[model samples]
Target chain A: MADHLSEPFKKSAMTNEEIMKTQREMRIQFIAFAFMIALTFLAFIAVGAEVAPPGFVISFIIFLAFIQLFLQLYYFMHLKDKDHGWANTFMVSGLVLSIPTIVALILIIGVVKY
Target chain B: MSETVDVSRGLPAHPERATLEGKNKFVGFWVFLSGEVTMFATFFGTYLGLRNGTAGGPEAADLFHMPLVFIMTMILLTSSLTSVIAITAMKKNQFKKMKLWMWITFFLGVAFLGFEIYEFVEYVHYGLGFSTSAFASSFYSLVGLHGAHVVFGLGWVLLLLIRYNRAGITLTNAPKFYMFSLYWHFIDVVWVFIFTVVYLMGIGGG
Candidate 1:
């Protein structure tokens, strides 16, 4: 079984360190995956169960969303890797530029109509 | 070429960022994604502002159902995982597994789109036409644009799979695949916001 499984990785250089690194990454991936699922459930519960105040529920879900997006960018997209400096720079700039625009839009649209 | 291509052993630790070509593509795509960030923020801002301007039509609180959006979120999130697994397979030079996982990601995307279409139809049935009010227009603008991205991503992944089917894992194709995964992850990130700002908030769960 081991011999058969090893065939696919034979074409690549499978050093012990690289293999260990991949194993560690896989473990982290599963953990992140599980945590994301749990977070989703909690968001649903916050709304469905009405355990918290209405205002608090909204903030709570948005906070959970922040965590999920961070994981998606840093872990899944590999943005946290050492070599991703320029990518990091661009993404940060994008975030910075968008915040003011979002706030201006909110102000212009005016929430009183709703 | 100054450097010969190594077709024998596996790729470097960061295969997609290993070569000059790879680095260029990787950095360029991030710049493009940054622009995308601003574009999407505009849409989200518009939607958030106008979400209640229903012109006496159906408001978001009356229109959105949490369960459907929740299911769609789970599907898209799972697709992100599948794409990550595909890249892992690529790092190991396991081309077949990479293809399989990418296909899984594609189909999951297709499923998510299906649900989205259904939701839009249900909304329209409930007197929420795009031209119905300011709220409806912005809703379509924000969420519909995202759906369009999913459609484009599906086509891009399929083209990559077919183009590289018989070529094996070359330096040229590795960066292409890596970029595709990054794009997929970005789509997932956008959905994270959509679920929070749009769905959760619309449902008064926030």
Candidate 2:
């Protein structure tokens, strides 16, 4: 058992159909990567060009950041796949818990003088 | 554990999750990642709160250089893509291709770390030491924590690559490499926020 586990296969087990499917998935991933890069560039440019108010630019860049976050988590990390229910749940819970934590800290620490 | 992995036919389509052990690692690593999300939020919240407390030190607007941050962001982002490619190749049982892409990812990560170290040195030279001010301390703690994760990840992947250098794509190492790729993507996700909340906001006069 251990020997088989460590041994390299003479050929891949993926069928031609499976290989084609994987290739298609790879293409989609590439498209997603391109979008992430575009989003990053947009965020940097939005800050660099200074075409908007500080408040607006801040929010814009943050919005872009969130889009990039979804792309990274879903596409790159495969969290969007069918078998990732538990992974998705845990990540969503973390994000849900995190918002309140961040808002509270900003309020308590930044607003209330200690 | 090895009993579950029957590789007699050929490499499994999803070699990373072929065995019960690999499946457990997959689920366990996600749980760890969830915890990490909250851990980082605390640092981020603290940084946001005290970012204004510069105490006469060089402020964010004064110290942050967009060009440097932009280049670092690009380097890290590209590394994320390379890892994605590596894992895709892994799924196809293209061992040599996967290894090549992983090496590219590793070098890109090293480049990103080099930029980060240089950025920190430049900040210290500008008098923004860890203890310089409330802002400085929180900034270092938050960004420095992320940097530490990068360092740890680089070490983890390097060790994996070296240990499995000649092992081929076995059921055991497949999960390991997949986990590292997930981790590498998570790092990029964090950097997206860092560049936005820290560097972009700093220079944008927020």
Candidate 3:
């Protein structure tokens, strides 16, 4: 129903046709990447010690890592809001399924219950 | 993207390149990435288990050399950025610019390979030979495979650069440039994991 209602971009919203990433934008994006990486390293240092449980710290870092990953994908990898449906679907599936399946296996194998 | 002036305008023939060239590369890349995800997933599982194993020998905390890995990571990541710049250059039809960036990218990749070779040499010297234990096997295999990919990617980029040095940015070479950039980025993604799982998480001794 919604599909019928929605216009097929009758004249699909034309893009600015401005070529990708101006020099200024590219420079800024690179700087932002550097900053995010620095923050990730800082996170590395923060969790360097025996702070919380190992898993807790790792999960926290991974949460932060995901943000950086998304930033890179959106800005650098160019999978921004303008992407097609398949890219989004594939990414979402990877994020949703890989975590549970992999983590569950790790838990099962490493628990060491006699 | 072929246009035919065949006065037969009744029904246009849309010859779709199987694998959809661009979409094919995209999907094929994803399929390859699936294998990668599964590969890394297995390593994560083993890493979690053996992380505690430490083989009663040594832990990640003692072994991690952050500076070396940090620089290596920086090189790989920087290559990702430059490759994109190359892609961007291609879109604007700047053949020379694309080649320059790709060449720069190629050199950076070689630098990364040099560092990896050195890192492995150091590991062996430090008595962390791959045959030492399960820990060493997984360690070398996972990280080394990534390094090998980088080496492989470097070769691919070099070949493209040489072959297309003068061809300029035609529609034909556009996809090739685009796919290389994709590969370069994927390698960076995998490195983020190596840094986290093998280096960072591996640090702190499990």
Candidate 4:
């Protein structure tokens, strides 16, 4: 009589461990958000003044901006948490295409004139 | 309720319609952003090449105003922060706060644009119109593109507000909201480079 009857399964397969894991992920996300905002603001202020040595200052500010860009994409965009492979692939593609494209253009211009 | 979804269970993977179709839209927006990055890169490279092409005119040192650009930067940067607050409100399922915060961002963006327009007008008045020199052209092209972005960004969110006037936070609008935030960040990134390479370096060097 019982042979054909199937046992009832629980609706939620998520367990205490899984729930804890999700909570941990959420906690980490919040921490990352806070950290990104804090660090970007600090650097924004640090390089916040006018200075000499034009080339050096420009390079440093670019460096800091680049840092903030990375943070924004990683944390707020949540690329780190999800679709890691696809996001990285697209980002790398942009980097590869852009660097050589820019350099080559500059070199061509260099050859053309002063 | 095409505009509604149960994100109460720790947020949906995709919000607007909460279906495969909606998720696709979210993914599509990111791809579009990559293209935007490339477009900006082209402008950046062009500016670099033409920066010194002043053609016997005033130089970057005398051209750039540190104080004006500084205030403009703060306005745009804070606008980005406000946009985050908007999204954070959205995540908490608070649609009114989300809309209010988005409007705050819109106002900040408008203020930033005002300063930029004034800055450009000031530059042109000082014998530095686009036709004055190659330096003028490059400077305008670089910062002008940023100004254009701000204008478009304001219009973008406004359209959303109008279109979704009666709707709450949906999966569709959520990604729309998220994409604007991304755009806001990209705008900031470009500005950071502008401040450093344009104002700081230009003033410090020239």
Judged by lDDT, which candidate is best? 2
Candidate 3 local lDDT, B1-206, one digit each (tens): 23332212211111111113545666566556655666666766665655555465555676778788888888877888788788766655566787999998999999998998998897787787777756677777778888888988988998889887776654345566677786788778777877877787776444
The residue-by-residue lDDT of candidate 1 on B37-62, one tens digit each, is 99999999998888777798988888
Best prediction by DockQ:
2
- lDDT string for model 4 (B1-206, tens) is 24344333534433432545555665676667677777777776766666777788878877777667777877876787678777766655567888998999999998998998888888777789887876687778888988898889889999997877667766556777777887887787678777766776666663
What docking class should model 1 receive? acceptable
The sequence of per-residue lDDT tens digits that candidate 4 reaches over residues A12-88 is 23446755755565566567556545644544454455443545655666677677677667755666765455656
Candidate fnat values, all: 0.59, 0.75, 0.18, 0.18
**What is the Å distance of residue A47 in model 4 from its true position?**
7.2
Candidate 3: Cα lDDT at A48: 62
For model 1 chain A, give the 10-residue run with minimal summed lDDT: A1-10
Error of 3 at B134 (Å): 2.1
Predictions in order: lDDT = 0.85, 0.91, 0.66, 0.68
Where does model 4 exceed 4 Å of error?
Answer: A1-52, A110-112, B1-17
Q: List, in order, the clash count of every candidate structure.
A: 2, 0, 2, 4
State how far residue B38 of model 2 sits from its true place (Å). 0.3
DockQ of 2: 0.75
lDDT of prediction 1? 0.85
Candidate 3 at B108: error in angstroms?
1.6
When 2 and 4 are scored with lDDT, the better candidate is 2
DockQ-derived CAPRI band for the predicted complex in model 4 = incorrect
Model 1 Cα shift for residue B34 (angstroms): 1.2
Task: Please rank every candidate by TM-score, starting with the best.
Answer: 2, 1, 3, 4
